[model samples]
Target: MKKILISGMAAFILSLAVPCAVYAEEYMDGRTENGTALSVQAMAVTEDIHRVVDVLKTGRMDEGSAGDASFWQLGAGTFSMSRNIMEAAQAQAPAGARLSSYTQDDLYILAHVICGEAQSYPDDEQLYVGSVVLNRVSHPSFPDSVSAVVFQRGQYACTWDGNYYREPTPQNWANARYLLEHGSVLPGNVVWQSGGRQGSGVYIRTRYHCYCY
Candidate 1:
């Protein structure tokens, strides 16, 4: 729903004063390649909020929300939409569903990092790259967003050595999407990976790297 920003949903995280008592069901159903049915009809008052929620659940949007102002309204609705959708995006890992927490840009950033750091590695290892990134996002010591963690100073060689700039292949996108949708396969505490850098603990080891907490 990138069209959401263009549709007038600006950054209101810090400025928003409205109290949003958003409640969402964490369980998703109607197993399909798309997504589950949301009981979000209660919140779909605005045309844009309805549209955005439908896209998240059904995997279809008339236009990219990023470039269209009609996709979502600005201000209070933005906070409501984002907050509720984030709660809606969460899923049990074994459910194997899309989290929808990462936006298009967020997915692109994640896919790029996965490709950059573990392209040549085996499937499990490549997937591990994404798990590690997600781990860092939830960790106390790292930034809270995917882009921030991937681009943080001295955190990854790929970001500074030009590897991060390479075009991510479809497989890279698949891996990133898989991790986000299905929840990370790695443990939440397993936040560190690869060589040189140190971690508090080790959890798994593949052909190319050690996954650590």
Candidate 2:
């Protein structure tokens, strides 16, 4: 999804157009993750269209929609219908997995931090690292947002290790998304711990990572 700049005049004209009718092209029709292409046999596309129409007519936006807010930001207050269309498109997407209320920047920052800190750990442990970051965000003690929590001084080694700037792998992305959507399997009370020492109370320990209150 590359960003494109639209001029005011063009945006004004587009705002007048009915979104669903104007942008009904087939999308995400590519091969699946398993490398199986869409069925060559002609399939009725009616059900999908009906879902889109229902979503649009109802004017209800679900949990998350791959940065739909940014798409409508250009027209701002002028394009309510257009926003519905985008939302509908998002709803109809094959992978309609709902995400936590975090924005794209939040997700990216989390993935980077998690990758930097626990890249060598197994998937669940990696998720634990991410859960720690998210936990801090939600907790009353730490900073409110992902960026704030991550950049807070003397907290994470990766922040100073130069690894925070490195690119995250695809698996890192998957792990991060899973954590964000489903949250930590560990108890919410279990918030802080380092790799080494077990603190006073009972701790959540798994593989190489250990978490405590």
Candidate 3:
């Protein structure tokens, strides 16, 4: 009886250990995939960042080809607009985190970082604001830069309230910077909040019918 009981206990322990190990491996694999996705997105965003910078430096916009478009439609205003956008996105970050470089990796990182931040806002508005910002960047009609899209005239409530450019708490900025540098987007189409226009309705798409508080 003693031998049987001892054997049973050992088997139970082994079973638990096996699942735990498998779970850990899965978790690590997910993390690795996430990192790769973010890196790819960041590269794309970095290219757009460079284009925006070039347009800012030279008043003339580069329309590369029929398929290619410049960072922003209005070439003359890109410098100031892009600067404002970057400042606003930077503000959304926590205090210590300063934008080191606008790399392709940065774009993927920004999406995850912003999504995390968006979680703090009311749940009803999180997807709305997130989708709006993402769409603004992904869409060719809007400025290719994240900063420009966030701070455009009357887009974000945070920007309108002057919080968009305000310095973030140091810890928050550091966390945001880390995520932007390391995070990736999960698979799925980005979703935005939908409802009647709240304040900055003009900047959002009507189809979603989402509102941001």
Clash statistics: count for each candidate: 12, 0, 22
Leading candidate by TM-score: 1
C-alpha TM-score for every candidate: 0.52, 0.50, 0.30
Better of 1 and 3 by TM-score: 1
Model 1: how far residue 77 lies from native, Å: 60
Stretches > 4 Å off in candidate 1 = 1-100
Model 2: how large is the Cα RMSD against the reference? 19.0
Instruction: Report the C-alpha lDDT of model 3 over 135-161, residue by residue, as the tens digit.
Output: 445545566666676656744555455
lDDT, candidate 1, 71-96, per-residue tens: 44434555665465444434422222
lDDT pick, better of 2 and 3? 2
Record all residue pairs in model 2 with backbone atoms less than 3 Å apart, i.e. clashing.
none
Which candidate, 2 or 3, has the higher TM-score?
2
The TM-score, computed over Cα atoms with residue i paired to residue i, of candidate 1 is 0.52
Query: Cα lDDT for residue 83, model 2?
Result: 51
Worst 10 residues of 1 by lDDT: 17-26
Stretches > 4 Å off in candidate 2: 1-100, 198-202
